[model samples]
Target chain A: MNPVRTTLVWAVLVVAIAVPIAAAAVSPLLAWRSPAYIAAGFAGIIAMALLLVQPLLIGGYLPGLPAPRGRRIHRVIGAVLVIAVAIHVAGLWITSPPDVIDALLFASPTPFSDWGVIAMWAVTGAAVLAAFRRRFRMRVRTWRHAHTSLAAIVVVCSVVHALLIEGTMETLSKVALCTLVVLAAIKVGVDLRVWAVRR
Target chain B: MSVDLFTRRTLLVAGGAIAATWGGGLHVPAQAQGLAPTPSMRGGSNNYIPNAPIVERIGGGGFWMTGTVRRAGDGAPLAGQRIQIWAHTTEGYESDPHSHGATLTDENGEFRLEMPQIVPAFGQPHGHLAYDSDGFETVFLRPVMPSSKDTSLRADFVLRPV
Candidate 1:
């Protein structure tokens, strides 16, 4: 990908990731700290990882000139994202093992926790599905369609998870993340519109 | 009329007795207490051990002190806290080992303190603390300093990775 596209991707990722973090940073001012903050932090981390995965799905959809290069970069970023997500989850585990376990196992008492867990499962499923797309004999267009739909679901669910949560990034981060979600939607919309016009 | 009256009286008394028994069973005593079957205070997991020990903040800027931490007042390792050690370098874009590093201080302060794990050239390190190739390397937290002193504990740390 060119610098512009790379920059845009990073921009979106930063906004998606940083907004929640910013919210977390101001958590003390809000005077709210509970299982909610831990939930929010984990959601942010997972969303950040998903942002890194976005370019991979993009590369998968858009073919031609240096496709292999994009795929390579995607793998590298995916690896890094895994480490980051692990760190995020690990921090939570150390902080509150019971709640973390609850979230992971779909037993968390809070409703928003379910959203996060669902997003995690969806993202994991998408990754696995993409890995075995060929084995399932999924046509390129069909697979791309499924991938795009799943990606949207992941992003949307993650955003909802973050919004419902109050943590270090209580307000501004949610607003910022919500804005990025809107921008990402616009980008996807434009891409679809262009594709439709061409069709 | 007499038989009917006697039968009604007996039925009423039986019903009243049942109702009284039910109420007695449902009622809580005047000395009702909170919690139940009090488990041993020393046992089970209701104890909050203060996981604050897991977050270790080290190697950063702003009158920061670099040191090592161990358990108790001994040279034992303290682990499981979020240990973030950070410091800064004078040169911009230059690497500093003390910039920002994190580790879970083990039960003993035998933490294998790695320098700030930055993306090097890719991502911008957020905090102002710097960790470059030069300057104070490897932090081994000795228990000599108390928590009241430099929070980092200023324990002796060697340059080698253990």
Candidate 2:
């Protein structure tokens, strides 16, 4: 990609991630939330935004970084994404353990909790495999298929989770970010053919 | 008979205002100040708790939950119907026990409760109201504020009695 196009892509990605974070920070609802709850909420928001960048990093959608460097950053980001999810869950746990427990057990009445819990598990599975693939002597092709499927689950379920939620991000902005995340995930999935591992 | 007829036919135009807010996001406009019926939206009541104690106010100051309780069809002010109000307020989260309270309508069918300002939860500044008093169909009204700065949220209910 030319320098101009690369800059434009990077700029768009930045906006895709940044605007929602900014919008949530100023949400009126934050006024009454506990610090732990607020932290947890933002952690979830960051995790969702980071989802937009992960595939782009691995698939070389963002131009300036070299392939090897981008992969390294992708690994680092994967770790951060996991941590953000942890904080998000922990914060909610502190604020309301019963609710979190219900969510994990899949007995919560709200539909969003079910989706969020599923996404969280998908993220956990992908991270665990990525972390131990070398020790397990996992085939690169096998790992690719598992990781891709889990990533798809994370993106799709998390979008549903966030959309089902009514807080933090503005409606239009949340919709915009979610739409972009799905589009980027699709672009990379189709372009890179990560979904299949016939080779 | 005519009074009952009016009450039955009376559509809480409040839904139109709610629709406007729904179309634009929960930014309650000038019209949501009137009482409203949930119509078919009890989904947002996922956080509802059973039998919250009636109290004088939810929080300290600024925000107000005010509306009228009218009989469906005739729009008669139904005094004595217990109206439960709760929200994520400066004092507590909507789910917190302390944040919930119930109030009764005056003879005029008007209800009012003062509390700390409502903050956004899940990103929208909103309040929850319900008519849990028996003898009438239960209603849960989740009304959003026009802006974070708005101190008052009104959701009048024209309840249909069973």
Candidate 3:
């Protein structure tokens, strides 16, 4: 990549990741919150930020990195995303088991709970399918199609879940980051053109 | 390359187009009324103690609250009742500083607590109090906002028998 172009790409990446994080750091809600809750909330926000990176990596949009290299980083980041989510839920569970149970059982009165649970299941399903892909002997075309479809579901549901919750996250920055995540994923999905591939 | 494969230029263009449309309307519904703030409930990992150590008083700085625990049906004072209180203050929330404490009621089913003056992040200055005793259903009183004009506050709780 040329020097000017590389600088521009890096600037975009930094701004995209940093803006939301900076906003979260300055949230008024952190003033009187416990350490554990703060940790859990920030972990969730980091996971959401990671979602943006995954698509950019998959689409080969990061300057100076080959698509194959980006894919490798994508897999590593995916594992981190799972861990972050676990921390988020576990923290909540520790605080209130009854509430967590309600959310998992789909009996929670909170609408955000339903969306979060759906997105969580989608993410887990995608991870499991990727893990067992070789064992199932699935064709490349079929696997890609399923993977892309699940990715879309994950992005949409996760964004909606984040947007619905009026919690620690600052509203404007959260919405902006979620919108970027959706746009990035859709852009990559369109680029892959999975639907047009012949079996 | 496969017939369905897209060129790099196509991906870039698509990404730009999607970005351009993001500023438009995208609505997320508001949370239903009566939903509790999730942060206020974080009592740490070992929140459940079989026996909470008894303390004479729980906070400091001229802010005191005295209350009595009684049975809902007959208004009988219930002694030895364990009460747990947590709140967020200017310093931080419970577990951050000295924002949480526990105490047992005296012989007359009355308890006195000393707490730092609180100013909550979102709502009015408040505290969370819970009562648990044998043969009685657990009771939780949340967002117990204090009146600034009064140095000493009177807040009582009535528990229902199981």
Candidate 4:
């Protein structure tokens, strides 16, 4: 890609991710919320934004940043994503244990909890599988297939989870980000075709 | 004539009893259902708990707190405003930390939150709301519900800038 086009692509991606976080910071809700809740809320926004990046990075969809460099950033983002989930749950736990317990136990009346928990487990499972691939005696092709399946689950469930929520996020920006994430996820799935790892 | 008068008085007493028994079914004025002359209370939220759990909904989600938050003078809808609500309910008292939760307004400056049916306490069924965001001068409200059977209550706030 030409330098101008490359810069445009990167800039659009950054702004798409940053807009939601920026909206939350100026939210009057921030004044009423506890520190833990605010931290958790922002962490969730960051994690969702990072979701859009992960697929693009791994699939080499980014213009300037190619696979090798993108992959390194992807690894660091994975760690951050995990920490974000931990903080999200922890903040919720502090505020109300029974509610979080119901969500974890799959008994919460809310549908959003189920989606979030499913996405969360899928992400965690993929991370663990990656960490212990050698011990599990998994070949490269097998690991790739397994990881790809989990990635697909994470993207779909996370999108539903975010869309179902009626919280502090501005609706227009939230929908835009979600739509972009879904399109990006689909692009990677079709382009990379990680399922056909049998070379 | 005396027998006819006695019969008329007996019927009147019976009709009065039935009306009293089913008062809620009567055509009570809709305008009479809310707190009369609701004003910002003096030290109303002295019982407000810090960090009282910001949540999307509270308890079993049967009752709702919904209203518009707007600027005081301009009456412009204030999107993204925060309103913290609590009441004595099946779960706990208004002062109980568990009973408290906060929610943010949407793009149109409207806010709604689900909570358990508020039970009457100290002879009044009421819900406490506070415009406790820093950008506005604090305004607290204690709105009286006309009946405990009410599933929803509305409390519109016009907050003055701090």
Candidate 5:
């Protein structure tokens, strides 16, 4: 499929997934028990897992991709992950508005809220720094350093948020997401260590 | 609800006079002085701690609200209020590249919400509520979205007339 077309398709799919979740706002009964939410949450976790690795996946750190193909794949995965996270966040919001607010504002008075809020801020900062890297005349090394740091923060916080929350994930999905978070973090750490040693 | 036409006329005339004077940069508008701080919503990340648990207070207003919502009657809990909230962050607007949104309420009338926690102290995050046949419009109660958390804080809105 054409990349642009594929992007459009995924965007719509995300909205389609988000609407019901938002509409379910009127009734919790319409939420929590729905399979759509479960599917979306797990799917989002998987896509986000890919998103976390996108820099390396695109930078040819992975074995299979030629430089150009790696770059293209990374971009595709990043876009897909954005859509996935949206569905994930939206679904959670529909289930519990107050709790969602708690997470976003770090006001839930729950420890998980702190982690979630921190992850959100880190993700935002990373995106901004990456976008303006060229304009700011940042050294490629510095940009890479900043990007990697922020990405790590995002992954760590998101994993914590997902793990602590009792809703949606349940036993199996929770285990799967946690596993992905750990594996991704470990791989990133190993890659960083190797890069440092080579330097 | 008696309308005092004489007072109303004088007030209207004063308001027009003030507008005309302000247009020419003459006198400062009287309306500007006594304006109370209206509650505003914000989204993004912040750290807000309220000073009082009895009075509904949100600390630091930007993209998020970190205050407590409580009941006015006997301080009992108000469990099910459908709240729809959205806001922007540094990365995008609510429901956009830099935003987050949610719909939820407390199970026992006391809920804690965290949306995008922005820190502008005056702007309220845009929010909607479903009163659930309680004769309250979605807009009846003042909604605030603070960007940080307040430990043991409560912001109460009285639904019935005092």
Candidate 6:
């Protein structure tokens, strides 16, 4: 990459990650909240930000990273995403068990809760599929198709889920981050022709 | 190898377009629009025992919130557990005068708190409570809203051992 282009890429990446965080930091709600709640809310936001990075990594669009290295980092970040979701849900459960139970049972009156639960389960399904990929002994094309389809579900549902929730996350920044995540995933999915891969 | 139809330049342009469209349509914060606050926004998981002195009170009036903190599975009462309570009232957030209070569980793991008479605002007249103890997992209760004409509320907590 040219030096100017490389610098621009880094700058864009930094801004994409930093903007949402800065917005959340300045949230009016943060001033009156407990530390545990703050940590939980930020964990969810950080998880959303990581969604953007995951697609970039898969596409090898991040500067200085080789394709293989990016894939490895992608897997590592996938695990981090799982942990982040765990913290987010666990925090919510501790704060309100009935609500979490309602969400899990698909009975929560809040539309955002339903979307969040669906996205959480979809992400977990993708992770489990990835872990068991070898044992399945599937053809390469079949595996890619399945994986990419799950990725699509993870991306779309997570974005919708985050956007629907009007909580700790600042509105404009959250929407911006979510849009970027969807765009990145779509770009990578398109570039890779994940849907068309065949044995 | 899979065929790539989107070149780097095209992908970048698409991303930029998405960013521009999204950035141009920003709106005010969601809370201002009457959306319910998530547990984290209200305050994170209530896991740690508050260090302040615990007030023990027994009263019933406009609304009295009472509960027992017990161990999950075993159903043992967690005595001496610290519980923090707060709520948004018609007056203001919990930080405003007479909107927040804390107490400790008695030997039987029972706690009682007196809530301010709050007219519904933002959402409903509700009380927020958090239970914390040395060895039990932290438990946070949602803002409890009065269901009927009852002036007393019971919001029990069952915490797992960590």
lDDT of 3 by residue, A50-98 (tens): 9999988988888977689998898888888888888888877764565
- For B1-162, candidate 2 gives per-residue lDDT tens digits of 245533523555666666776887654443344435446243336457878787887757678889988876555678888888887778987678888888888899999988888876543567888777689888877776878788899997888778
The weakest ten consecutive residues by lDDT in model 5 chain B span: B48-57
Taken over the whole model, the C-alpha lDDT of each candidate is: 0.46, 0.81, 0.70, 0.77, 0.48, 0.70
Per-prediction DockQ scores? 0.01, 0.21, 0.08, 0.03, 0.02, 0.03
Local error of candidate 2 at residue A128 (angstroms): 0.3
True contacts kept of each: 0.00, 0.39, 0.11, 0.00, 0.00, 0.00
Q: How many residue pairs clash in all the candidates, one count each?
A: 58, 16, 1, 0, 53, 2
TM-score of 4: 0.59
Model 4 C-alpha lDDT per residue in residues A143-168, reported as the tens digit of each score: 88898899889888988888876555
Expressed as tens digits, the lDDT of each residue in A1-199 for candidate 5 is 4577657745653553344334324432223234544554555455545654564564455555545887677656655665566666676576445546766766654566677668767866776776576798987777777877887788877777756654333335455545645565667557555346335
Q: How well is each residue in B68-96 modelled by candidate 3, as lDDT tens digits?
A: 88776556677988877655554545444
User: After superposing candidate 6, which stretches have Cα over 4 Å from the reference?
Assistant: A197-199, B1-162
User: Tens digit of lDDT per residue, candidate 1, span A82-174?
Assistant: 455556566666544655776787665445677766766676666766678779898766676676666666677776776665344556656
Displacement of residue A145 (Cα, Å) in model 2 is: 0.8
Instruction: Mark the regions of model 4 whose C-alpha exceeds 4 Å error after superposition.
Output: A197-199, B1-162
DockQ of structure 5: 0.02
All candidates: TM-score of chain A: 0.65, 0.95, 0.95, 0.94, 0.64, 0.95
Docking class of 6: incorrect
Q: For model 5, how does the per-residue alpha-carbon lDDT over B38-157 read when each residue is reduced to its tens digit?
A: 232232222221111221212232333323233433443445544333333323233332132332346655545443333211122223222223433222222443322322222333
**Model 3 misplaced regions, further than 4 Å:** A197-199, B1-162
Q: After superposition, how far is residue A103 of candidate 3 from its true place, in Å?
A: 2.0
lDDT by residue for model 6 over B1-162, one digit each (tens)? 977789898899999998887775453333224332122223323222354345443222356778887666556677878787755433344444345568878899898876644332212344567755567666666554544234666777777667
TM-score of each: 0.42, 0.66, 0.60, 0.59, 0.42, 0.59
